[model samples]
Every structure is written in structure tokens, then in C-alpha cells.
Target: MPLNASLPRRDAPFKLGATALLLVDMQRIWLEPGLDPDHADWGPDHYFYRQTREVAIPNQQALLRAARASGVEVLHTIIQSLTEDGRDRSLDHKLTPIHIPPSLEAGLPPKRLAPVGDEILLPKTSSGVFNSTNLDYLLKNLSIEHLVVAGILTDQCVDMTVRDGADRGYLVTCVADACAAPTPERHSGALKAFGGYCWVAEAAEVVARFEALGRDAAA
Candidate 1:
């Protein structure tokens, strides 16, 4: 028997109603500068900032529009602690020295990617939203089996979420062009590293797939 014999086909079509668009850690902290001036090295000239502002953000906007139009559930996750003092962060985060004050706007998504209507936003303290939040339970409750992911720091939060989601049995797809990392090499390497765990495609392909699903449902 093949290793994937028991798993759903990797190329299976997405069912719009059962699919969801999960934007991971797209908050102002990562997308915008000046939020963490201490790390001034991550300025506008940095590869991470450049890739996110020039490539990822615009592509994610396209995905967001298609998701809304196709009625795909949209969810956002941001790295945040439950308490202002940062007592609620995961051990990994604490050790990593990654701290985001609960009261700061750093946890909020950028204006262009803000949630609309009944869309949801989940706050997490760990790299993997599935590990620190009620995301898995919420997905189950919403009957979401297919998760389309897009976000920043492709080598960190996005990579963790994609791998974890796949192991938990969700049909996961990572939008390559809609995610960025500390550097171009890290971004591409993370995608290639996790390529076997989930479907990896560009933003345009994902939007097309979502649109196709909508058409099929309407037929």
C-alpha cells in the first residue's frame, strides 16, 4: 500500500462551502514598519519587508476578494498574548523573545486585509495557531475541511500552520506568492520543505481554483 493510500487525493477539488481561507499572522506588526523599531534591520530595504509589501500583500488582496465572492470562510490569526504583560505566551515564544502586547494595534490586520462581515480573527501565542488557539475546534464546528493559507514569514508561522493542518487531516493549500519570510531563500526553502505536506501554488492559481469551484457549485 502506498503511504498516501489512506489519505485524500492531493489533487482533489476544493468544495467552496467546505473550504476556508486562513490568513496567518498578517497583522500590522509583520506587515508594517516602525512597530518594532528595535529590529530596525527589518526595515523597508529588508527582503522580508520588500517581499511582503511588493508581492505578498497584493496577492493576498486578490485571494481575499475571490474567497469572499465564492463564499469561502475567511479567518485571520495574529500573534498575540492574552495578557498585556505577555504572561500567556507559549514557552517557545517566550524563549524566542517574541512578544506582542495585547493592547497594541500590532495585533490587528492591515486595513486591506481586515476581516469583513462575519469573518473571524483568532489570537495565538505560538507559531502554530492550531497549537495555541481554538482554531481546530472552530474549523470542525464550521465544517471546514479544506484550508487555503496565506500569510507572512513563510518560514515560520505559515510553515508551522501548513504542516500542522495537514497532519490533522485538513486538505491544506499554501499560496506561495501570498506569503513572505525573513529572506527570499527562506521563503522558497520553506515551501519546498513542506511541499509534500500540502499543495503549494501561487495566488493566481488559488483564486482561479476558488472561482472554478464557485462556478461548479452554481451549475
Candidate 2:
């Protein structure tokens, strides 16, 4: 994905009071090449690095800035096991053919940019953030009913989280450019699969809509 300068202006501002931004799996394990020294080495040929650098990070940064300026609560969703022994991880992580670790110390940490302000970090042991964390509780407490989602591994964690958010009745807007997958095909497929459940847009468009909301409030 490239930087989209043509941002769409909403006809009217959305209910900004009920909106929040959820950034999922934007951690070092996925974003940084050598964060996990023990993991398989990735070179310039790695699709993950190229997509993240060329597409996701920049878009995510734009969304974060816009959300902060618009006063939309910003939250991060990360995958982490509750126990060192991986007992709290999902069956897929515990089983073969898909063994995922539950610790960030070795493979995870926010990579491109650090969380500032009072942004809350929600940890989960499963693909869906809501399934393993108190994300629902936090959203309810904050009265957040609309969510703008962006992050890495668009085909996995982000997809699952979006589905969960939709099922819980939140109006979701997925920033396509701010998300990445192992391949372009997988990324596009994931977005298409969940397109019906959420309003998908580029980061620039989402940022424009958010800023438009601010303008409406000022007016």
C-alpha cells in the first residue's frame, strides 16, 4: 500500500464521543527484524519487513496522531501468555504445526513507535484480544462503541479482533493501509473476508474523518 493523499471527507462527523482506536499486534516480533534473535532470521527479502515499513507503520503513525488529536481513546492489543510455561496459551499455540510463544520478552515489544500518554495496553493469549483480555470491560467503561482498528498480521489477530468487535456491536472501521499480512494476497483476502462486518478505509481517509469530527465540534 502506498501513502494515500486523497482522504475522503465524511458528509458529517461521526459520534466522536463513542469512538476508540485499537492497534493490534504492532509489536517488535512482527515489526522488527532482529528483535527475536532466537527466531528465524529475516532479510530484505522478508515480506513482513517490506510491508510493515512501506505500508503499515506510516499509516498507523498517522492514525495514532489523528486519534490523539481528536481525543479518541487509543488502546493497544498485544499477545502475551499469562504463564511462563505457556499453560495460558491457546490450543494452537500449545499444539504442533502452530506453536506460538506467549512471551514478548524474546519476540515482542512495540517496535515502530512507543505508546505515549495514558494509552492502555491490553494483553491477550489468543488471536482475539477480547477473548483473552478485559478489552470489552475497558471499552464499556469508556463508553466506546466505535472502533478504528490497525496493526500487523492483518490475516490473523487483526481479523479475529475485528470480528469480535463487530459481534459485540461496535461500529468498526479498519484502516487497510495501516494493516499488514505475510503476503499481499493474504492481506487482501483477510480484508475482503471481513469487509461485510466493518467499514474498511485507508488511514488517510480515517484520519480525515476524525479531523472532520473535530471541525464539526468546533463549528
Candidate 3:
């Protein structure tokens, strides 16, 4: 596939070197079962579970693989309680405290598809990664002007991050298929809300964009 201007080309808005893939809450804790001891309260039955399991996870894996192969930095983010007692969580969390186990068995990606040694791991206790973590500083330090955003809960963390990133001057590409919400309506609504704020794209198209860039470089 040839690189085209109609597509969200990293070079047109910002150099490829200034771009990165920001994967938010791709954790098994939220996408899989048995990780959280409190699964009875919020488990596979959750409305977003199937979408995250069947759609977001696989697409996220592909995007991460492609981003790494193309030499684009891959950054992961997780929303977890800072303390076992849930004392450090945000006010929203305070109102709705979460009781997840302190285990990495499902908190991170599978070992076979885990982030490479060079990938950055960012932890946050809020819906947005930028404000909760040092994401802004890190992006600025690395000169990242564009962000390819994907992950679970399209209407929450992913949505908040996209808006924040855009506000901070980063060209954001929201991977539609690589994000989910409690329902189809919520997922669609979130993307619709972000319609004017970012370049909303499908996972396949995003993958093709990266592959096209690779081909262009080879030529």
C-alpha cells in the first residue's frame, strides 16, 4: 500500500520520529477473568468484557507489534489502585472503590506478547494518563508530537487521554476498533465525540499506514 495524504500520515502533521503508540489499559486485569479476586462484582459479565476480549486486545497486540517493528516507540498505561487499601485512588475511584488483587499475573500483557525491554510502562490512578502520570513530561522529553491511541474503554480512559493529548498539541489518531465501552452505543458515542478532535481510524487502516511507511522507507 502506498502512503497517501488522505490517510493520517505521521509526516504531514508531525515527523514519524515524533510519533508514538499509546496503549491504554490493555491489562488482563480488565480484559480477562480470575485476575481480580473481586471478579464476582465486575467480571466477564461486564458489558465491555466481550468487546475488549474479542476486539480490542488482538488489535492492540497487532498495533504494538507494528509500532515496535517500525521503530516507533510503544508506551503502555494501566489504571490501578496505588494502594492495597485504595487510599490513593482518584476521587471518582473513591466514590466507587475497586478491589483488585495485587497480582501482575493478569495486570500486564501475556509474557509471549509482553512489552519489550525498551517499552515504557506508565501507571495511573485516574481516567486520563497524561494528568495522572508523567506522560506529558515524557512525551515532551522524547519530542513526541503525535500519538496513536488505542486501548480498552473507549468512553473513559482512552477518550480522556485523546482529548488531553489533543489539548496539549499532540496529533492523536484514535483506533476505533481497538477500543471498547460498556455498549456499542457508548463506543460509537465516544468516537463521535472525538470526531472533530482527532483522526478516528480503524485498526486495519492504522496497520496499513504503518506498513505503507515501511514500504516507502525501503524504496
| Cα RMSD to the true fold for all candidates | 1.8, 6.7, 5.0
Clashes of 3: 0
Q: What is the lDDT of residue 194 in candidate 1?
A: 92
Best by lDDT: 1
Residue-wise C-alpha lDDT for candidate 3, range 129-184, written one tens digit per residue: 98878999999998987789998678889999999998998888899999988789
Candidate 1, residue 188: how far the Cα is off, in Å: 1.0
Model 2, C-alpha of 187: deviation from truth (Å): 0.6
Worst 10 residues of 1 by lDDT: 34-43
**Against the unseen true structure, what C-alpha lDDT does each candidate score?**
0.88, 0.78, 0.78
Model 2 C-alpha lDDT versus the unseen true structure: 0.78
Give one digit per residue, the lDDT tens place, for model 2 in 43-136. 7569878988887888888888887888888898776666667776788766632323664453454544567778898767778898889999
Ranking by lDDT: 1, 2, 3
Please give, for residues 112-178, the per-residue lDDT of candidate 1 as tens digits.
Answer: 9999988999989988999999999999999988999999778889999999999998999999999
Model 3 segments beyond 4 Å from truth? 1-14, 34-47, 99-104, 216-219
**Candidate 2, poorest ten consecutive residues by summed lDDT:** 4-13
Off by over 4 Å in 1: 1-7
TM-score against truth, every candidate: 0.93, 0.85, 0.83
**Cα shift from native, residue 197, model 2 (Å):** 0.4
